[model samples]
Target: MNCEVYKGSRKEGAYLFVADSKSLENLPAALTEQLGDLEFVISFDLATRTSLASADPAEVMASIKTGGFYLQMPPGKDLETC
Candidate 1:
């Protein structure tokens, strides 16, 4: 599926992937707080990705499928790695 990627202002190397810009409005409150400001990075076809630098494609798809968004935390942080 097509998706947009946003980087969290409060964390380095952290990324938030959503179905579209509209999805940002539907993110959970706690998640928004944790992520702080968001900066649009890039938009791409997620359905064609086989691998990512810091996250598993299948897991990211699962989150996006269930939550309408995916939080890709850095290699080591407070939450689970995306």
Candidate 2:
């Protein structure tokens, strides 16, 4: 799947990945408010990776498929933001 990653302004090392970088409005209001603003970081294909630096590629892809986006929080902050 084609994926785009975005950095969140409210927290360092946090990112949001989605299929369409242009439609950030589709994100949940709570999530959008928690993250503050988003900045485009990079884009990649899921078929190209076995794993990501911090998240599992398959898990990330699955989250994007089901949730419309996947949140990657920095290290221990994963459970806190959601």
Candidate 3:
């Protein structure tokens, strides 16, 4: 399956993947509002990838198939609490 990817302005390295280039229409208004302005990144084929930077390719594909979108977030940084 192929998908169009978009980067979130609110968070670094955060991405939203959709099955179709026009699939952004299906996203909730709240989500888009939270994600801020989305920057077009690159198109990708899920079948050709085994894994993404911080997301499982298969899982992302599955989500796209079922939910029409998948959000990829950056790895969490370790925090020290006193």
lDDT of each: 0.84, 0.84, 0.81
State the lDDT of candidate 2 residue by residue for 1-82, as single tens digits. Answer: 9999998788778889999876587888888877888889998898689989998999998898888998888776663553
By TM-score, highest first, what's the ranking?
A: 2, 1, 3
lDDT of 1 by residue, 1-82 (tens): 8889999877777789998999999998888877789999999888899997887788888888898998877656754333
Off by over 4 Å in 2: 79-82
Count of residue pairs whose backbone atoms collide, per candidate: 0, 0, 0
What value of lDDT does candidate 1 attain over all alpha carbons? Answer: 0.84
Task: Pull out the clashing pairs in model 2.
Answer: none
Quantify how close model 1 is to the true structure by its C-alpha RMSD in Å: 2.5
For candidate 2, the clash count comes to 0
Global local distance difference test of model 2 = 0.84
**Per-model TM-score versus the true fold:** 0.86, 0.88, 0.84
Q: Which portions of model 1 miss their true places by more than 4 Å? A: 79-82
How well does candidate 1 score on lDDT at residue 17?
90
